[model samples]
Target: MPSNIPFRPFHRPAPDISATRKPDGSLIVRSNIPLGNYEANIGAYWRAAADRFPDRAFLVKCSPDDTWPELSYRTASEQSDRISSYLLSRGYGPDKSIMILSSNSFAHATLMMGAVQVGIPVTQLSPSYSLVGNDFTKLKYAVELTEPGMIFAEDGNTYAAAFESLDLSDKDVVTISGKDHGGIRFDDLLGPVDSVSVEAAFSAVTGESLAKILFTSGSTGMPKAVPNTHEMLCAAQKTLEHVSESLDAVNDPTRVLDWLPWHHTYGGNVNFFGIARVCGTLFMDDGKPTPGLFGRTIENLKRISPSRFSTVPAAYSYLADQMEEDEELGHAFFKNVKICQYGGAALSQEMFERMQQLAIKYIGMRIPFGTGWGATETTGTGTAVHWDSEKVGLIGVPTPGITVKILPVGEKLEIRIKGPNVHAGYYKRPDLTAQYFDEEGYYCIGDAVKWVDPDYPEKGMIFDGRVAEDFKLANGTWVSTGSLRLSLIDALDPLARDVVIAGHDRDEVGILVLLTEAMQKKYADQPGALSADGRRIVAPALIEAVQEKISRYNQGNPSPSRRVGRALILAEPLSVDKNEITDKQYINQGAVLSNRADLVALLFADDGSGGVIKLNKNNAMKGDKDVRNEQADTA
Candidate 1:
């Protein structure tokens, strides 16, 4: 009943893994493939890429007028050398870190490469911390913690408020524009090039040298500074290249057009550094997955057909909807894309099917959808789903250099990672470092997984849920929040953007859902239907649709731990400043629950108010005052 369209030529060896069981019911899984030799520093890869393809475009900036400015590998290397010489002349080193507060840009990349190549740790903070809120709390916190010697901003005038709020008396403020605000011009740094000094500093860079300090998403709390060493960054990409047979294919440079923020691990360490490793060209995408900005991404796609397309699950949902409607966009998307990759969350079966159908329609073949499982602490990715497959939630086997330890914890197997790529510890926070790593030096990542096939170990693992996120109801029935969340998303496809499960220590589970753009548009005609942010439901018809859908979902998942008893469409979007959402668009379940405790209380109260949609055992949607009153009296 399914189309037997073969996948495009994607060559990667089959998973070769072995496992060792411990006395405490913990299993250590590893790949038989070796990591082999890798570059000493991430900057070395950039140098090699320049040597391989001197005049090839290393980075391309998309423009509205089709004047896409490109920087060649040789030009980038030379400019980076000049920047490195400048930093060296100023006596910048490990202690004098460079902090960048701008979004992804050519100057940002060049500055990062220039600094990291010479052992000066560079910290790239999310622009949201500075530009999103008026308070600038997170920005101040990062400034206080990192204690950077120099701070870089794309525009000093745009971040004038952010700069005024911080103590920059002793720090150097550099900007590409808006120098009137007491900022140093970025162009002035290119006056001289100390070639001998630059070479000596670069040569002294060892595997232990700190290349970058990437901040964690701060989902649960304040962001932790994770120091990434040269070994970690270089080793991660090397393992992927060593294992993925087609990575360095002859005459095929890895070309990717991406918009993932460079502040995050997926964008910075993986995409940026990995592309440089294989002499690849990275087209800088100025757009994002959000509503107003996605048009830019589509425009960029129209001009440059990337070899690999990768993004978050939310972005895929948006793209799939757009491609289904716009034939030209679909054609442009699948024009030369060899693989479509997703991370952050699991893709729904419906979304996956729609993409494959679009691929079949446009490209005559199903492009392989690849995903991996890892975090900032693991450098980038520890496990990868490299093979061609349609199945979602398959995180695949451990990569060549990494080992995954699955330890039994209460009915779930918690995943811990260990490898050369893994971070030694948090930056200057030995307390947090000691708390995360175990006796065997494995970083306890706190994620849970299960075997896809116990008999066949190489079949890979499925994400169960976060071990810390799982909680018990009043009757002590444990709930796997991760699995339940994914199932609920699938059950409410085309309607729910994301669902956060709430019912810790309560009688039953309830879901706080963020509605999709399409769902909001469908109910836009009704007066008082949507909030100003277009997230809430004031219209009765929209509320009823959600109630009916979840009732059907509860029909199939009748178990206490699986079934959601009530639903509430969120009125307010997740707050980035409050740590409710990550830069990669991942909803922090714990942060949401903690910040919106009042909403959780209302979901549990269920006195038929606040647009809470409840369902009874008779499969009846109950929002009527009489029904709720009677139920409340009985309780």
Candidate 2:
């Protein structure tokens, strides 16, 4: 637990919730607070924001030389109106959707709003689909599913190969720069506005009207297109607003620096529209949480001290590593930030304490660190941690206008959500739509949760691991991979970036560890750092450290379900093309395991190959005499 330092105050609404036990022992949770009237159309909020804060900067981005170029609300409105007119003149309507292949940018923001306001559904695909791989399989899948009438990319020359691979003969290609393949310049879209036509289209928009089509990360299989209606997006923002009363929003200086890709729900629906709903400024961060790219995020944080910092847990780990060594960066990041939030994965308790300690040291009070639970199927977040707390891993309670049902599944309680913010169905995939929902119309989210306090249901729920990720050993002992992964991450701390649990049908558990960049760099100069084949890192100290940590963990958790019996260090990076990793840096456990079945086999082979570390039945350290530097294939 963190020290007794007082938490910084934010006007967050208290958790007002109630629960009812069903006849079958299922628990239904609902928020007592009512969700008042909200905008039925997303465009209406844009108009209201533009009218109120016309001169205020709504979107900001970094130039090559580190200058911030901003787009004011009024300017964005005028340009979007022009874009709406141009789109309408070209006969693009609800069915003739546009596909955006670019990342988060001011231009992308304006174009999305422009098209959606006038009834043209826009599809945002991960740039990794186009730029990261040679096959472009996911990109082709998305194009075939959406059958878009137009495509937009930031640079035509950069994405020319991707466009060439796709059959875009009848589709229009729009680009901001590099006029390759006879593409239409994005600036050309800014034409004269037809107010009467635009007004008619805007007025015709309803809650059921399609606004955007977002694709899943394709971790399980081919990406499924999720339809975002005007009602879903608007109501989600309203629920978010009612949950967290931002001081920044009230003071008129709410600024956010974010790098989560706009293709995902967290970035696309929440951060993008949620910021706009509050009339706040979003500084589009181009940096990612990778080794060579995270420095750009640090530089952005140094320049723009935002009021709120929301990102994934992996990014927070990188930020913690940076802030621990760099005092100036820590001071700058904690200067104006009121709340720190995370989602997409569980944050380790060690990380939460470290961040709160840093906040107390620099800011005189601990800034409230929070998290929420949601998915692409749900508009954004159905439940959130809205109160001040010193603990981590609590997903809070149901937000207004949402209901969560907790049904017992084996030893875990599976969570299902029903709300106005939930999407109707997947685009053009009736089979998938029918398969995911229950007879009661609640979407089965496949996640498990437990009440913080069974007696006091208002305390919210703690995230138990994913129901599908859990697997039983050969002995029939079920292992909760979600909780186990977090435990391994906390145990490995600065050495391992992530660990994928192997051994589903085996007698015991094993882990494939992805080493942190610092760990690799720190041991690169040491003797015996590289394996005999120069494929894996076999530093004696690194291996010894890992063995000792896992040994201690094994001692602490002796059960077969929790104890790790063997471990292997993986050298290859997770591939975006293979769906092993998302753009937000979240590892897809199923994808990684299936994609690297050889590694999983090597982990359980017991031959001591590939620098495999093993522990005796009594949790004693196994001698490393046979732990050889076995060469393995890389993805």
Query: Each candidate's lDDT (Cα)?
Result: 0.85, 0.85
Question: What overall lDDT, based on C-alpha atoms, would model 2 receive against the true structure?
Answer: 0.85
- For model 1, where is the 10-residue window of minimal lDDT? 626-635
lDDT of 1 by residue, 1-635 (tens): 16578887788878899999999989999999988998897898889888888998888888777688889989889889999999999989999999999998889989999999999999999998889888888889888888999999999889889998888888988998874355478886665789899999999999999999999987756789999999999899888886565665347777898888899999998999878877888888888876568888888887787889999887777887888898988888898788888998888877788788898899888888888899999888899987877588788999999999998899898999999999989988999999999999999989999888988879899898899899999999999998899888888888887899999899888999887766655665465565443444645667777888898889998999998888878857678777888778888899898988877887788455546777787667776563334334433
Q: How many backbone collisions does model 2 have? A: 0
Candidate 1 similarity to native, TM-score: 0.95
Clashing pairs in 2: none
Off by over 4 Å in 2: 180-183, 246-252, 524-527, 532-535, 628-635
Q: Per-residue lDDT tens digits of candidate 2, residues 255-300?
A: 8988888889889898888877888888888787787777898889
Candidate RMSDs in Å, in order, are: 3.3, 2.4
RMSD of 1: 3.3
